[model samples]
Target: MALRIRNHIPGLTAALTILSLAAVFAAVLGVIPQSSLPRAPEPLIELIPHINAIISTIAVMTILLGVRFIRHGSVRRHRAMMLTSVGLFIMFLILYLYKVILKGPAEFLGPDVIYQYIYMPTLAVHILLAIVCIPLLYYVALIALSRPIEAIYESRHKIVGRVAASLWLISFVLGNVVYVMLYVVY
Candidate 1:
């Protein structure tokens, strides 16, 4: 069964990644009509950024723990942690898109110097890594889901997983940093 799906992984990964990226861009760019979606309460909409910040923080910890677990040969624990991280990532994305589609991206209240020198650069790198991560993450996760633990070792899981995890951690951490710069800082 897993072997059958193995052959189609690349196709599946590409299709899903493209669709995911498209939906994200559509939402962010306002191509997705806000009137088409049900609206959340004002408070819930406002709380999404903070909620996603906490989710991103948890995802960072989970990615680190997942890597540590795998290194220590605790594959079951590692799988659990990694899957948890993915779940958190999904939750964060849904909440974020909802807010962005309804309310638009958050504005930075900091000074121009910080916005130009720090915020823009940080956001650019974070968005870049996040876009890069989508395919890598989908590949590794699909490989893991379609294969048994023993077979996963034979696939490109380790190499891809390492890259995905590294970029994923950096992306999530930078997301939290962006959150702070927007919501907490001047």
Candidate 2:
């Protein structure tokens, strides 16, 4: 079973990535009716963005630590950190989906000039990176989880992991910036 899964990493990654992105889009697009979703309490709804911000921050830290661990040849620590980051990412996504499904996306209350010239562009790039990171992250993660450390180095894991980590870090940073713009600066 493990061998079968290991051999189909690419197909599995593509399928999982597509399904994950589709679910996210469905929530964002309101294809899942807000009426059908149970409402989170007002306080939780309001707090989710803030909670996501903290999660993103922690995820950023873990990704950095994971990279540092790998660079230092500490495979176990790196794996732990990377898996923790993935867990944080899942938690963040669930909260974000809940908020979006219940109340929709947060409105920008910042000035029109900043919103147009800075915030929008930043957000666009952040979102694009996030979408791109999904497949790359999934690919690298699947490879890592399926293979031993020695075997991973012989595969595309290093190349893909580097790209995934870089973009993942950038995405988390930009997400935090977006949160500040929406919740704090405004």
Candidate 3:
């Protein structure tokens, strides 16, 4: 396994929670402008979506490879994918927070009722759960690394797959939707 499965499940879970919350708090508190490097990279909104694309690709690969590994009973590769996906996600979050701090809040497309009711809720949930998923995602990955073969292939393990897929889908889809609205309509 690429990631060693900690027998101390509770401790690992708690550590994951703390890590995610710290990142969220950092995002919310607003990094000082001086903390950001001006010469590092100007915020390129156009290139940003590519990061999301990469993440979505990684997520897809992880899910597919994970399923395959389980079926074939290749524990190591499955563990690799799990670790790789989590690494990609953490990298995504760093870039995301950097982008957000560099630019500020999301650009709303419209103030209409439809935007308020439909768009806002979707966007809010997308962002919030994306943060929450940080820990859950890692936990799922660690489990895949640690769990027994029988458990790995079970429907129960698929629960983690479902959650990962749902969160990544919402994040990617809503991201594209918001991007389109901001750049095209608003």
Candidate 4:
């Protein structure tokens, strides 16, 4: 009889754990009243355009980290960056969705003229990318996690990793751009 082993990556579980926590936090926040919610820096809009600025900044950091990890040829770190980016976006999505679910989908900010064009595309693309990317992430995670040791890193993981990176970057960058246009520009 032979024992079987799966492919292993050192830090992926930890990254997932952190992401899970963020997701859970967002979900929890959704059902609770603001008075009952844990304190953060104030809610995003009340904090002003600075919140969008921060998310956009993190989006840039995620891209830079991802590119560096890929160029350096660290498959492990590359996966970490992608996972982290996805994790952050998950956090963003949870918050974004919570706000929408709680507050309704129309903007209460920016001038009417700019808000009209500004949000329509960003909102459509953000939503479309989200719908598409969720399934893609599931499959990519499956491809990464389902294989055995040698199969994990040197083979399927690379393909899945590339797909994950591209999808996540597009989603994240577009999300921030949408945020900027709505909050910062107009």
User: Whose lDDT is greatest here?
Assistant: 1
Tell me the tens digit of each residue's lDDT in model 4 across 1-186: 012223333244345545655554555456445554444444653543345446656865875797688789776786676667666665665565455444534353777766577667776776566555565565556555466445666555567656656666676677767767756665
- Angstrom error at residue 25, model 1: 0.2
State the lDDT of candidate 2 residue by residue for 18-112, as single tens digits. 99999899998888888987886899789999999999999999999999999999999999999999999999999999889888888999899
| TM-score of every candidate relative to the true structure | 0.98, 0.97, 0.69, 0.61
Better of 2 and 4 by lDDT: 2
Clashing pairs in 1: none
Ranking of all candidate structures by their TM-score, best first: 1, 2, 3, 4
Worst 10 residues of 2 by lDDT: 32-41
- Residue-level lDDT for 49 in candidate 3: 53
In model 1, the runs with Cα more than 4 Å from the true position are none
Q: Candidate 1 residues 1-186, lDDT tens each? A: 777778899998999899999999999999999998999889989999999999999999999999999999999999999999999999999999999899888888899999999999999999999999999989998999898889998989999999999999999999999999999886
Q: For residues 8-60, could you state the per-residue lDDT of candidate 3 as single tens digits?
A: 55578678789777766666567546366453455575566566656756665
- Report the number of clashing residue pairs per model: 0, 0, 0, 1
* lDDT of predicted model 4: 0.59
Task: Sort every candidate by lDDT, greatest first.
Answer: 1, 2, 3, 4
